[model samples]
Structure formats: structure tokens, C-alpha cells
Target chain A: MNRMRIGDLTERAGVTQRTVRYYESIGLLPSGEREGNGHHYYTEETVARLQKIDQLKKVGLSLEEIRDVIELYFTDTSEVLPKRKVLGILYRHLADTDQKLEALGQFRSDLQSNIERFERWLEANERD
Target chain B: MNRMRIGDLTERAGVTQRTVRYYESIGLLPSGEREGNGHHYYTEETVARLQKIDQLKKVGLSLEEIRDVIELYFTDTSEVLPKRKVLGILYRHLADTDQKLEALGQFRSDLQSNIERFERWLEANERD
Candidate 1:
């Protein structure tokens, strides 16, 4: 079984060492075994876990929500039920993202109009 | 000239007093005149500024970016040029929001697939 240091894990995970430590501190990542020199050694499974965290973070999952999902992943409950719950959360998040997108679209439109109005004002002033 | 109290502004703006103060502290809002009791009284123009802030916040503008936009609004520069710059920033924000939406869509699809796979696994295990 291959083990990796904290720096190695962070490099492989494509996240900063501080982020990895923060995840561990916040219990997003499980604590690794410590060596005699106080260095933490993580198993290969840590890479997969970090990848999942990265994916969830990319999807805008809050750290708290990601922690809940990670807990569900580790729990002994019926896998189907937990996954269904996670899917429900994902659907809700999708709805939120859609709403945000709509809001951004509106903002973009408003900004465009403001720009055009300003252009007219400048043109009118320039003729004066 | 009509003036509004801090409480009134917060209520009308649909943001907390703390958020209003924080915005002011971050210079997103201009400092208002103080009454005899040291209470800040805002003019009607404040409402429009607050509304703009609310709209920008809805579109997920960071406080720093929002401050820049607000500053541009007040600057004596050519209105057309400033507005054009703001529009550019809005366009970039729209692109970012679109990307985030795409990522969320992918996450939702992945979660749905995970749920279905888990269901199949449960069914298979139950039959054994």
C-alpha cells in the first residue's frame, strides 16, 4: 500500500497545501496516520476523496454541505437512499444556479442599456 | 429633501443594518451626514445607490468589484466610456456565471447517475 506525504497529496490533488490542511482541520478530509517525526502519511484513497471534494467545490457546494455528502459516503446506510438524497441536493443546487444565471443575464442586459444611454448622453453633449 | 434613517434604509433595501454598515465601511456606499444624535441620515439618492448595490450583489459581484462600479458611476469621466467599461465587466461576469451553470448542470447529471447506480447495486445485493 502506497502512502503519500501532505505535500504530495496536495500536489496530486491540485489544491494548495493550506487548502488540504484546512480541509483536514474542518473534517472534510479524514485525519491521516502520523509518523514518528509528526509527519502525516495519507493512503491512496485520500487522492480519490480529494478529487471528490474538488468536484463538489467546483459545483459550488458549501464546505458544510460537502461535509454532509462525505459523511453520507462513509456511512453504512443503504447506499441508494443516501445517493438519492445527494441527487436531490444537487437538483436544488442546479435550480439555484439557474436562478443566479438568470439574474446575471438581467444584469448584463441592464448594463448594456446603461451603456447605450450613456453613449447617447455623450454624443448629445459632444454636439453642444 | 427626504431623508431616511438607517433602519428605514435597511428595511427598504432588503438588507440587514450590518450589511449596510459593512458596505459603507468597505466604501461601497458614501458616508452619510450625521444628525445631532450621531445617527447617519441618508438622502433619497442613497436609496438608488443601495438599489444598485442590491442588484449588483444579486448578480454575484464581489464587494470590491461593486465598489469599482459605484466609483465609476460617480466619477467625472465620460459617461459613455465608464458605462462601456462596466458593461465589459458585466459581460465577463455573465461568462463566469454561464460556466458555473454548466458545471452545476454536470454535477446534477453526475449525481443522478450515481443515484441510479446505487439503486442498481442495492437491488443486486438484495437478490443475492
Candidate 2:
């Protein structure tokens, strides 16, 4: 696997340098390997990790929440410790997803009713 | 109708003073009526509006998005102009809610399978 510097990693991952640095600072990403030339380099794995983080963010997971489950995507699932830890995280995320699903469902219903109400009004008011 | 100050409004609405001011600034909440002693007073309706905005926020609508539909809750929906505008917003929100529901459903399935995988691993490894 080829190694890339932070600039290349961010470009490939479509994230800002600050995001990469922040993830590293917060222990969400591993510290980049220091090269002999005093430059930090990352593996292709880091690019994938950054992209995965963005995907999780879109699904409404916080950085802290992602920390609980990010390993599942990248770590060897055959490992025992992370699997147990991730099992707990997975259960928690399932509950959160259910709650979000309920709220979104309710909001969808409200939107539908409002849309129907508006359409009825327009039909009554606009003679066609 | 009894008019209350901003303090009462936020307290009843379960939001901060800054939230009230911000919503007012953004036209999500109507500006509080100016009182005789230079104090800003709001009606019961303002409290309901603030509470409604919080509900929309919980359902993941941005402030700008809320601005589009908040009036539907407060204004007379019989009016033609706002009805047309909100019809567009309601349709957009319905589409967004469907997308969210689909994504959340997918994530829920992924989590359930992961949980089951971990459970199977633990069961096999423990021999209990």
C-alpha cells in the first residue's frame, strides 16, 4: 500500500486539513507516521477512514459516537476485545436509529398532512 | 389575552433567551411586541411558536428550513400567498424525511446484523 502525506490524504478523502488534524488530536485517527524528512505520512487506510468518518457524520453520528464503532469497519472482526466493545456500541446505535426513525416518521406524517392541506386549499381557491 | 415578557416566553418554551432573540432575528419567531416600559413582551402564541421551532429542530430541520414552514403552524393557512410558499417547503421536507427514514432503516439493519455476529462470537468463544 502506498503512503501519502496529509495533503494527499485530505484531497483523496475530500476533507480539510483541519479535519484530519482534529481527528488525530481527538484520537479518532491514528497519529500519522513521522518520516525521516520530518514529514507525517498516512496509509491508504487513513483515506478510507476519513471517508468512513464522513459517511458516519451524514448518518447523524457524532465524532464520539463514531469512535465507538469506526473500528468495526477497519479492524479485524475476529479480534475479541474490540468485538465486545463494538457489540455494546452497536446495540446503542440500534436504539438511537430506532428513535431517529420514529421522529423522522412522525415528521414525515406532519409534512404529508400539511402538503395535503395546502393542495386541498389550492384546489378550492384556484379555479382550473 | 395575557402578555408576558421574554423571560416568561423562553421559560414556557423551554429555550434560551438567546434562542428567542436569534429566532426573532431570523424571522422564525415574530419580533416580540414592545411594551410601555421599553420591555419586550410576547403572547402565548410566541411561546407556542418557539416550542414548535424546537420540535422541528429535533426532527433535524435547519433554521432556514424551519423559517419556510414555521408560519404554517402560526399563520392562517387560509391565506393564499404563504400557502403556496409552504407547499413547496412541505414537499421538500417530505422528500427529505423519506430519505432519512430509508437511511436510518439501512443503518438499523446493519447494526442488528453486527450485534448478532458479536453475540454468536461471544457464545462460541465463551462455551457457556
Best by TM-score: 2
Listed in order, the DockQ scores are 0.39, 0.63
Query: Every model's Cα RMSD, please?
Result: 5.2, 3.3
**Candidate 1 structure quality by residue, lDDT tens digits, A1-128:** 46989888888878888888898899999888997889899877888888888777766667998886665445554633555565576566557666765766776666566557566766776754
Residue-level lDDT for B34 in candidate 1: 90
Model 2 Cα interface RMS deviation (Å): 1.3
Which candidate should be chosen as best, given lDDT against the real structure? 2
Model 1 — TM-score against the truth? 0.67
**What are the Cα lDDT values of the candidates?**
0.72, 0.82
Worst 10 residues of 1 chain B by lDDT: B72-81
The best candidate in terms of DockQ: 2
What's the lDDT for residue A103 in model 1?
A: 69
Kindly report which residue stretches of model 1 are placed more than 4 angstroms away from their true locations once superposed.
A1-3, A33-39, A43-45, A70-77, A80-94, A108-128, B33-39, B43-45, B70-95, B111-128
Model 1: DockQ score:
0.39
